[model samples]
Target: MTKYRPSKNSDGFTIIELLIVIAVAAVFGALTAGMLANATDIYSDSLERQKFISEVRSSFFKIIREATWQKSYTSFAGSNNKKLNIYSTDGKSIDYEIRNNNDIIQNNDQVSGSNNEILTDKIEYSSSNVYYLDQQGTGIDIVSQIENVRSLKLDFQFSNDTDDLRLQSHTLPYNLRIGRAMSYHE
Candidate 1:
């Protein structure tokens, strides 16, 4: 009877084949890890943007509420000027001025002359923007350039035509959108 012998080559994968398999597995693992990392980064950025937007909206609404409740200035400038002179939140002062240009200037706290404090920057007028002020009256990270902003209407609801407000309605009739696109380059 012939001696039966098992071939070594048929027993399992060759060393080269094992190495190739390992390389493929390593590549797949790397890809998966990279994808996961990218997703995490995007999620984190979205959260931060949402927080910023919420804060901006809150500040704007607060200002509108105050305007509606106080209703200090019937006219912007005068009886025929179409402008109103309203006192600032701080009762001791009456230096806050709202102009026809939709710009608000809060004068500095002084017993005499009024120094302008621009609440919203020039770029923010056209765009639905948010402004952050530092302790030194410097603006930082003014996120303007909104996608679309047709109108930003602030209506003061009064109990009667006398401008004594019972409630206020702040409406963004058009798109009230805000976003930031970030690009990365090696």
Candidate 2:
């Protein structure tokens, strides 16, 4: 009654065990693939969003900088919210407006024919209301006259398929003056 012998089938794993192991491995592999795909999609979307934001910021910076140096502001062609005329110190004028409701056009040399520069194409819809700030920082509409304009406010929006970004800049014009009397010492 003291016999020790190993079974013949113990040399390798059974077919059922092999099948179970393969099925488990396949499930894990599929899960990993799915997660990778999801991460890739998220990364792609994030990149697109970042690019859009960068472009918008760049456009705004250029617009604000130009507006800061504007010596004159006027409405364009009897249109208040649709267009603007900004004059620099060198007597050159530029127009800022939305063309066809989608393009941010900056027309340099408004006295000439069509020198439009596209600032950004992401403008789905935009409208600008230029308010002239008084000495007390009150916003007053400059409908047909532009005098004593201390600052100008430009509010606009940019949009893509799934997102919208709104931006505003209140720029002090370079030609603002208070006309104070200077005291002289004898």
Q: Give the whole-model CA lDDT for all candidates, comma-separated.
A: 0.40, 0.70
Q: Where does the lowest 10-residue lDDT sum fall in candidate 1? A: 74-83
lDDT of 2 by residue, 6-47 (tens): 767677889999999999999999999999999999999999
Model 1: runs farther than 4 Å from truth? 6-13, 71-123, 126-152, 155-186
Query: Lowest-scoring 10 consecutive residues by lDDT in candidate 2?
Result: 177-186
Candidate 1, residues 1-186, lDDT tens digits: the string is: 999898766868889999999999999999999999999999987786565455445535555543332222211222111122333334433333445464545554435565675543221223232222223334333224122222223432212112122222433221112222234510
**Collision pairs in model 2:** none
Extract clashing residue pairs from model 1: 75-83, 75-84, 76-83, 76-84, 77-83, 77-84
Could you tell me every candidate's TM-score relative to the true structure? 0.41, 0.75
Q: Model 2, which residues run further than 4 Å from truth?
A: 1-14, 72-79, 109-114, 124-128, 177-186
